[model samples]
Target chain A: MWRKVLTFGVLVVFAASFLLAAPVTIHFWHAMNGPLGAMVQKLVSEFNQTHTNIVVKADYAGSYSETLSKTIAAVKGGNPPDLVQIYDIGTQMMIDSGVIVPIQKFIDQDKTFDVNTLIPQVRGYYTVGGKLYSMPFNSSNPVIYYNKTLFEKAGLNPNDPPTTWEGFKEVAKKLTVKNADGKTVQYGFTSGLVGWFFEQYMAVQNALMFNNENGRAGRATKSAFDSPAGLRVFNFWNDMVQSGVMINGGPGWDNANGIFASQKAAMLLDSTSDVGMMLRQAKEGHFELGVMALPHPAGVPYGGVIIGGASIWMINTHNTMKEKAAWEFLKWLEQTEQQVQWSEGTGYFPINKNSLTKMMYQGFYAKHPQYLTTVFQLLMSNVTPATRGGLTGVFPKVRATIEQALSKTFDHAMTPAQALKWAQDQADSAIAEYNSLY
Target chain B: MPRKYVPYVLLIPTFVIIGLFIYYPAVMTFQKALYKISPFGNRSFFVGLRNFENLFNSPSYSQEAFTTLIFVVASIAIGLTISLLFSLLLNEKVPGVGIFRTIVFSPYAVSPAIAGTLWSFLLNPVVGYVSYTLLRIFGIHSEWLTSYPLALIAVMVATIWQNLGFNIIFFLSGLQGIPNSYYEAAKIDGAGAVTRFFKITLPLLSPITFYLAIMDVVFTMFTSFGIIDIMTQGGPGNTTTTLIYRLYRDGFIYFNSGMASAESIVLILVMAVITFIYFKFVQRTVHYR
Candidate 1:
């Protein structure tokens, strides 16, 4: 018994020593929870299976905000993860924080890396002062999701969905059902109301949401949401709520999606990224659904919606070899085949234009033509600096103000003018405050 | 045991841990606060007191500081009061006490992220069960998280609900530890329930109360990060942006490490000072055996 125990103890020590000598582990922190979280783990497993020298450990770090906080804390503590997926709005902040080495330089160093073929809009957001800082991992935008059954139930043609705001309003009013006491039984339209959605909405309307090339040019520009077109959009949204044509979908995107999925609301404006999950839920509920471009205001420019999604930055928290490994991973991620697989699996628009030509994407589109809108939105986007996206040093703060403004407008707590004025004032102050730091 | 060196041996592990985890970071944060670092890991020349000066001059910091204070104070005060009241009621021979206890303590066991996610879903303006019930019952419809003035209140409500259970458990333990002889003595002296509670119960639970208050204050300030981060994100016009969240944003979001480090040092100092003040001023008011 003593000899057997000694043998086991010796084996355990040998295993421990082997593990200690294993290749350097690169930690990746992310906020992809639920199904996507599992999918990410699978991706890491596949990566580990292929790569023998590098072991990538995936840590689930709650929501996007939580993940950001954790990454920052780690960076501050001088023990940051080798890789982290940061949301687009935080790109500027992350770029300014010198810890991240631009992956473009590394890609440039690698003769095989063909980053030039990257989807322009995807790469555009991460490029700071004409240099790319991060790689676009997930690119999504708000799209109009409608319940075909609800459209039919309201005696409207299921195939014909609204494309313009006026048309949307008329259809929404018609589709809204009232109970015996005149209370709403089924709402016509709802959306995840926040600045990001409004920003996309404004982009669709060809309105200048902010100045300084919408933060792509430089950080000195102030927000231009107080423009005439901006006021009109806010007023239009307010009117929809006041007329009971729309309901407060929820404070954010997920809530809005829930209301529509539950059939409590007929139409939803949510991220195209949620398409896969929504489709699964719809299949389970046995509800037929339709997808359409987000409704644009009448007579607006044909400038398409802004790209909204997350990207991965190569943080300089590692040594040269680790940096090279990260670049290799990023390059692999951007490859047409990989992009096609990722986009098809996640319902996010591929960040590589070449990926769209892949048979996998074509096959998916052939099965569900609805999948084409994700690519169409990208192609139709106005290539001008302003229409590309909104930028500001304090976009996170500005987003909060817009949410507050919209909340009050929707809740009947204040008028559109009042809310806009407050938001404008708040945003102006935030911009000024953020500018002072430099 | 080796009696001569026993104390030193025992003290070594604790001192090493405290040094590595707490003291070392505190000292490094103070050092980094003086130097401005760029996004490329480029170190800037030391700008003595400039980050603090910038913090004071900025309206965002002012707003964040005030919000943090309000959030910490309100959450702790309201959470403790509700728990205390519930504990008093729970002390009685109530039906299904164990079930009630479990229900109250359930939120405590939940991770803060889960708690935030669940409560955010519950408090959503539309399709949220809580919101639907509240509106139907009271004819009140408000965006709990998005409304500017009330956003803080909404955050506090979610925070208190998730925390009240844990506080109740603490208070319950404290209440049970109070000997029955004291209550029996109070009854003999013709003390009514209110007097007994105010004079005897409250006073006797003072030590636990002190500890809970300190722990709650520190925990609420430093840790609520998850709840606020997930729920409000210091949003709806920075109404819920606490000091920690702002520190996070400035440091991580913008990569303003110098500012973040400066803010961290300030945060630590504020926490230490407040704790010292509480122990000195408030701790004195409490009675303990």
Candidate 2:
């Protein structure tokens, strides 16, 4: 009698456990770190708790560069994860790889999901030829962050920052301070010399960076950065450097951020995502911080800040059930509450339109006015062909080429036109290589 | 299995590992050089010698070749000279010989990437203490990483510093094997230290010097990837990009496998010819006891 009862209990326990075991687990690789990574973990855990039928495992890949490189290796190795977060610059390459499923297909098969709810400018970056390729996640724009205390010390208005390039130069000249030995103790302005600034400044002037309407109508065959507007931007920057008001800060973002945080520079041009970081650094250093949109020429009417950040893409090289589970997780991620939580936690502008209406978000933004500047900048953007962003399969490489050009002109005494002409040639060749392959 | 085949059987594991990790990829690299491959390794097409032709005809080829030549030759020369100096001093009858040997050989334990990062931080104009002192004392603002020539020089310094310890050890061991009777005889014959070093010690150390020279050249040519990657990344206008770095950039960063493979083939041919020349020239001059 004892033996029979024990066998029955064991069989029942095994059967119940087998029946309750979760279905396929979705592996997601992303590049979020620090507070943003923690927020992503929280969201994934919440989804796991709500959906008892499936489990989602989130892994933090290093940076966008590392993540994309690893994802390419994973795809070629035939062991791809269910989802990956790729930067917007990688959209063309992602599509060319043919490793991802169009999120539109999932939206088409599902009746509840709506693609129209996405913010237009944010959505436009990930779309190609009338098809949405990836889900927009973190999006930001370049903004001018200034030391409020320094502005007051320089006798400029603390509340009003320059919105035009010429006016900005004038204010920057006033803000620049030098020691008795004629060595500059504080530069008037410093900007990150990465390729994104060129892209953003071009968008602010309403100029296209690549041919074929910024490559939305068709594939880009060449880069258009050596045009008249580009020449103007380069010449303006060259004059700033020559005048001893602006520091090049080299080509890395960390160097520029260091220059700004250490109070060696009165003003800095950087990403909107860094608003929270900049404020935190200022608080630690006891400096007042202010924010404004990036400056272009006088006539463009704040033409616009272009979107900059990574987006999430679903790789469908797995089984059908896994893809379904991944799609469900993505849908849950796109919820209004989740979007607000992400934006508030990470200072990335909200990708969802309805998320702006939430009382919690409003309260948070009221407390942090610096973050609101990004929202207004995005709202006021004109969404021109230039602002939609340059789409080429070799954008990452092209950006490297352009940054090299910036270095040559900024540090090596090369003329702006000469550096830009060399960049144009290199970019054209790179684009040709990419186009031939695809 | 025959009894005579047992030794062959014992060697099978090593052979398999070498074949799998070394020979197989080498063969595949040669094969892949003839084709244009997609990102996913699907839809490959043969393009013959076009990849090679394009690489040679490209405008950046001359700069890359010159940079590689300068980096390899300069690093090998610097490594051998410094290591030889240190080894000679350490091989003396000085006190704390063991500690001095350890001190001289300690840097070899550091990985190339760490060394590169350390030197980069130390050489940074804004934050580096070395640069700060130089500016304060002498008013010399050396752009260690910004200017193309200075950046290549920085990379070479880092590479030579990291490789010096290994060469020192080889030269030290070579010094230990030499009989002391000849040195005493030279001293008795009224030969000065410099004359004794050149006539007696150098000839005795020829075999070791030959070995180290060939190895230093090969290591600088092929194994300086990590230093180049961290310090300069072949930049300021491709001034620090060596041939190996170029191969990796084209293959991985640009996703052009055919050209990378063609570059790899060229690298192999260059290395093979270098080794042939090195052996033909240096082996004849080496004197064994």
> Which candidate number maximizes DockQ?
2
**What CAPRI-style quality would you assign to candidate 1?**
incorrect
Which one wins on lDDT?
2
Cα error, residue B2 of model 2, in Å, equals: 1.3
Taking every candidate in turn, the Cα RMSD to the unseen true structure, in Å, is: 6.2, 3.6
Model 1 Cα lDDT, one tens digit per residue, B1-289: 5898999999999999999998998888898898766533444658898888888897878988888888888888888889999998887788899888898888888887788888788877766788788768775665676667666887787778878777899899999988999999989999999999999999888777777788888878887877886777676656688898888776655556788899998888888897887878667866557
In candidate 1, what are the lDDT values of residues A134-198, reduced to their tens digit? 88888888788888988998899989888899999999998798865666767889886677887
Fnat, one value per model: 0.26, 0.26
For residue B179, model 2's alpha carbon misses the true position, in angstroms, by 4.5
Model 2, A42-161: lDDT tens digits are 999999999988899999988787788788879877888889999888888888887889887888899888888888888877878878888888899989899999999999998988
Interface RMSD, in order shown: 4.4, 2.4
lDDT (tens digit, per residue) of candidate 2 on B1-289: 4999999999999999999998998999999998877655655788888888888898787678888888888888778888988999999999899998898777788888788778766765444667668767766656576666788898898888888889999999998888889889999999999999899888888888888888888888888887887766676666788899888777666666778899999999998998897878777666587
